[model samples]
Target: MTSPAVPRQPLLDDAIIALHAPTQAWSGRDGDIGDAAIDGIYHGDIRHIRSVRIRVADSSIETISRSIIDAATVEFGSVLRGLDDDGADPKVRLIRHRALSAGVMTEHLGLHSHRDVPLSVAVTVEVAPEFAPMQDVKAGLAATEPWHAEAIAASDGTPGRIEVRSSDGHRSFVVEAAGAAATVADTIVLRWDIELDPRSVVEIGWSATLTDDTLVVAAAANSEIAVPSTDDPRLARWVEQATRDLAALRLVLPDHPEDAFYAAGAPWFFTLFGRDSLWAARLALATDPGIAASTLRVLARLQGTKTDPATAEQPGKILHELRSAPLSLPNEGVHLPPLYYGTVDATPLWVCLLADARDAGMPEAEVRELVPALRAALTWITDFGSGTGSGFLDYVDETGHGLANQGWKDSGDSIQWRDGRLAEGPIALCEVQAYAYEAAVRGAQLLDDLGEGGGDELREWAAVLRDRFRDAFWVTTPEGRYPAIALDAHGAAVDSLTSNIGHLIGTGILDANEERACADLLLGASMSSGFGIRTLSLGAAGFWPLSYHGGSVWAHDTAVAVHGMLRSGLLAEAREVAGQLVDAAEGFAYRMPELHSGDSHDAVPFPTPYPASCRPQAWSAAAAIVCAEAYAAAP
Candidate 1:
C-alpha cells in the first residue's frame, strides 16, 4: 500500500494560523480573537508552513516541521479532538500561514492544536547523505495496529535513517511514515496518532498512528493551552503573551550530563541552578508531575559533596547555580561552567524540599531513602561550609567564576557592614542559617519517620542552630533593630539590616517577636516598594532597585517571604506582598520572569525586564505554586 499523492496540508480546515490581537487572552479566552502579535519564533520554518499543506484522511491531525533543525526534520501534527479545542460545534479549517520576520527566535511561539478534528500525521525527510539517523528514538516504530504503529526504522537504498537530535546533543524523536526500503534522497517519514487533544499541555509526550500506506512511525506531541472566551481585550492579549512565554520557557536538556541548561532567549542564560530548575519544574508540575519528579532526581543525584575549590560542592548540598559557560573571572582564562557549584542556601533548601515532598504525601520510604544525602548536607555545615572555620555555614568560592556571596543573592554588594560598606568574601549569610534551621526542623520530621535518634538529633541540631543564630546574628541600634544579614570571616557583623535577615523568618528560625518584626520590616515603608518588598531597605546606602540580589524583587524571594508571613501568622502582611506581586504579574502578562527590578510604582515610566536575566526561569515558575497557596489564603 502507498500513501496517495496528497496536495498540501492545511493547519486548520478554515481557520487562519493568525496571531493574537493586541488585547487578547492566551488562555481561558472568550469567543472574540484580539489583535495580532507578529513577533514570535514558530519552531517550524516559515518557508515550510507558508502555503504548505498535506491532505490527510483525519481532520484532527496537523503537521508542522522546520527545515532549520537537523534533528527530526519531520514532526508530528497534534490532533484537536477534545470538546475544548473547537467551540460548541465543529468548524474545521486546513488553516495557517505565519507572517515572517528576522530574529524571530527572540520572541516566543509554539504549535497550536487549533481544531477538534482527529488526525494521523506523518513526516518524510531525506537524511544527511553521510550519516544514518538513528531510528531507535521514535515511538512504537515497526509495529502493527493503528494504536501500536507509530514509527518504524527504514533506510534508503543509499544510506541513513531519520532521527532528531537537540542542540544539547541529545536525541529528541524519530518515526517512519512510509516504506521499508528507499533510495538516495528517499523521504524518511514519521507519523503521529492523534490530531490534537485540548488537554495537551506543552509537556513531553509520545504517540503512534496508522497511515494510508500502513506505515508505522513514532512521534512527539507539543500542545499549548489557549483561553476560549474572554471579555477584556488586554486580558486576552496578556493570556496569549503568557502562552507564548510558556513555550519559550521549555528547558533544553543537554546531550550529556556535563552540559548546561540554556534559556532560549536573549541574556541567553544557560546554567544548572538547582533552585531555578526546581522552581521552573514547579510551574510545569500541574501539567506534568513527572517533570518535577525528574527534577528532584537529577538535582538530588548531583547533591553537593565535600567542598571542592571550584564549587565548594558539599554532600547532600542542593546547588545554588551550576554553569557551563566562560565568563570574566578574576584571573582565570576562558573556561566553560562545566558545573560550577557556588551556592550556599541550596543545601538546606534541598532538605526542606524533601520535607515538602513528605508534606505533599510522598512515600515515607522515598523520603527516607535520601537521608544519607540529608545527613551529608548537615555534616557539610560543620565541615567545609564553615569557610571561616566558624560553626555557622560560610561560603568562599574556589573559582573566580563562582560567586562570592554564595546564597541566593550572589551579587557583590548583596551583603554589607552596619555602616553600609560592602563586606568581603568568606562570609556566612543569615539565610543559610535560617534554611539550615528549617532543614533541621524538617529533617526531624523526615528522620522520625525513619527510626531512632531522629527527634533527638533533629531537636539538638535545631536548638543549637536556633540559639546560635539568635545570639550571633541579632543586632540592635537606637534607630531600628533586626537580625544581621551576614558575618565576615573574622566574625564581625555585616550589620546591614536587609531583606536577607528577614529571610530567616521564612526558615522558622526566628522567635514569634522576631518573625513579627521581620514581617513588619518587609511591609514597612522602608522596605516595601509598593510593588513589593525591596530586597534591601530604601534607606540603606547599598540599596539599588535593579541590583541583582541587592534590591530586585524576585517573585520566588517574595514567595519565601509570604511563606514566612504565613508561618508567623502575619496574614495581612503576607497578603500585601503576595497580592501586589500577583497583580504586578497580571500587569506584565501573567508570566513571571527570573526577577525584576524593585522600583517604586511610579519610578519607572514602565516596568523594565531584568537586563541579562533568564525569563521563565525555573524557580520563578515554582514561585507561583507557593503563591497560589498564598492567594487562596487571602481573606
Candidate 2:
C-alpha cells in the first residue's frame, strides 16, 4: 500500500488572534476575517463564523494602527479623511475594540468626528458563519457549501438577532447588534446609520454567542493564578505576556469543572492533551501548584482502563488527546480516536508531576485520594511500560494508523539516525528512560510518604534501569560522549546527538559527573543555537533550521533542559539557556510560539519564526514560568 502524502497546514505566522478558553478569533491585522486560510471565530473545535468584514458604505477608511490589548482583547484604529475637514490631519477616527470570552465575542465600534459640521455615516458589517469543524479548517478543507442564516425581528425594545445553525443542527450561534438593522443574504449584514454632531463620538456594539452541544472542555472556573514579577524588565515583560496567554488557555472538563488544565494551544489544539498538560503544569508549578493538582486529577479521570491497540490505550495509561470526534489526518497517516492513549512519556511524567506537586503544596488529603491511581500508574510502568521486552519504556504503533513516534516529538519523521534514516520501532527514546527512571524513584518516595509498600521495589527497579541506560544509550560523538536519541528495534543506539540527553540531568538516572558532561554538551555551540537548544545538533545529517523536530528550537524542549540544569546545580548553564529563550520570546513579542527556527543568532539578528507554528502553546507559554524561576533561583 502506498503511504498517504502529508498536506501542508495553513500558515498563521502573521494572523491576528484574540482568545479566551473555548473561544478564539483569527483575523487579518487590519481587523477583517474570511480571506486567510486560518481566519475564523472558533468555539469548541468548530468555526462558528468564517468571515466578518466592516465597511463604510460611502466613505473609504484606511486602517492606521492596530494594538493588542491582551490575549482576549484587541483594538484597531482607522481614519476616514474623506469624511473629515479639508486638512492635512485626518479629523475623523474609527476605532474597533474587540473582546472575547467563553463561547462569546463582542466588538465595540466607535466613530468620532472632530470636524466642525454634522456628519452622517453608514456602516455595514458583513458576517458569514460556516460552522466548519476545526480539523477541516486546519486541513485547509474549509466548508464552501451555502448555509442559511435566519434573521429574527427586533424584540421588545431590543435590536434584531441573527440565528445560524450547522447543517447537522449539532451547533449554533446567535448574533445580536445593538440599534442596527439586520438582514440575511449570502451573509448576515448589519447596518447602522448615525448622525454625529460636530466634535462628538458615537459607539455601537455587536456580540455573538456560539453553542456546541458536544463539548468535552469548558472555560476554567477558577481565577487566574498569581503571576510572579521580576526586577529585570525584559524577563518581567516576557512573564507578563506569557501569564496573560496562559490565563486565556485554561480549560476544564465539563464533567469535572473544578479541575482545570491549560489547553495545548490556539487555532488548533485548544483542548486537553496528556503530555502537553503534564509538562505545562510541571513548568508552571512555581506559579500555581493548585493547577498541578487539578491537572493530575483531570488526567487520572481519563486514565486508560484496558488494552486497545487501535486507540493505543493500556491499563493506567494517560490519554494522548481528547476531542469531541476522531482526529484523522490521512495525509500524515494519523487517525487517532477521540480518546487516544498513544503517548509513552505521559504516564511517567504524570508520576513525576505528582511527586513535584506534593512537594510544592498539594493538600495531604488530595494526595492520599490519588493513592489508588498512583498505584495503578506504577503498576502500568512495570507491566505494559517496560513489557516491550527491551528492558526499557518503549512504544511501537500496533495500528499503523496511529502515531509512529509516541515520544514528545510524535511526528513520523521525528526519530532519525545520524544518517537521517528513520529508526524502526519498538524504539526506546533516551529521554523517556530518564522520565521513567525519575518516575520510579519519585513514585517510591510518594509511596514511602504515604506508608505504602513496594517503595523499595520501585527504587530497585529505577536503579536497574539507570544502570542499563548508562551502559547502553551513551554514544561517543566528536565533541564528547552523550546519550543517543533512542535505541532502534535492533538495539543499536541511534547516534544522533540531540537535546534528549539534557533531560537525563537531574532525573536521578545519571551520576554527578555524567550530569555535568550532558549539561556541557547541551551548551556546546552545535546544540545551543543562541536562540535555544536545537532539537538536533548542527552536526547531524537530519538537521534543518526549520525541521519540525529534526532541528527546530522548541521553547518547552529547551525549558526542559533549563529545568534539569537548575536541578543538577549547573546554574550558569541554566542561565544561558534561559537567556536565549528570553531573547527568542522578545522576537515573538513575548508570546512564544510552539517552536521556532534553529537559525543561529550569529547568522540572523533574531530567531526566525517557524511560520506555521502554534502561538500561545501551553508548554511553550509555561516555559516562561520556568525561565522566570531559573532567573529567580540563580540570581
Q: Residue 235's C-alpha lDDT in candidate 2?
A: 85
Report the Cα RMSD per candidate.
14.0, 2.3
Residues 1-635, candidate 2: write the lDDT tens digits: 99885556789889999999889999998898888889989998999899999999667878989999999999999998779776899999999999999999999999999899998899989999888888888787768544667877656756579888877877988999978999887888999999989999999989899999988899997748778988778889889888898899999998899999999999889999999999999998999788899999999999989998889889999889999999877567788889999999999999999999999989889999998889889888887896468889999989889898899988988999888899988999999999989999999999999999999999988899989998999899675788898998989999999988888888988999999988888888899999999999999899999999999999999999999988988888898899999999989988899999999999999889999999879899899998987888885
Candidate 1, poorest ten consecutive residues by summed lDDT: 21-30
lDDT of 1 by residue, 1-635 (tens): 99875322111111222221100011001111111111111221111111112223433333332221111111222333332333564333222222211111011112344444443333222221111111100111111111111233555542223343233332132322232232322222322233345423222121111011111111112324333234434334433444444333334233333222212222223334575555454433433343444446556667765556655565656765443323333322223254655677766766666666566566666666677876776666545567666778887766555666677776666787646688877888888888878877877776777873556776686788788877888777542788888888777777776777556775778878888887877887777666566777767777777787777777667767876776677777776786666655764555566677778766664445565344444455445554555555666
Candidate 1 TM-score versus the reference: 0.61
What is the lDDT, from 0 to 100, of the residue 112 in candidate 1? Answer: 42
The stretch of ten residues in a row with the least summed lDDT in candidate 2 is 144-153
Q: What are the models' TM-scores?
A: 0.61, 0.98
Going through the candidates in the order shown, the clash numbers are: 67, 0
Best by lDDT: 2
Model 2 bad stretches (over 4 Å) = 1-7, 153-159
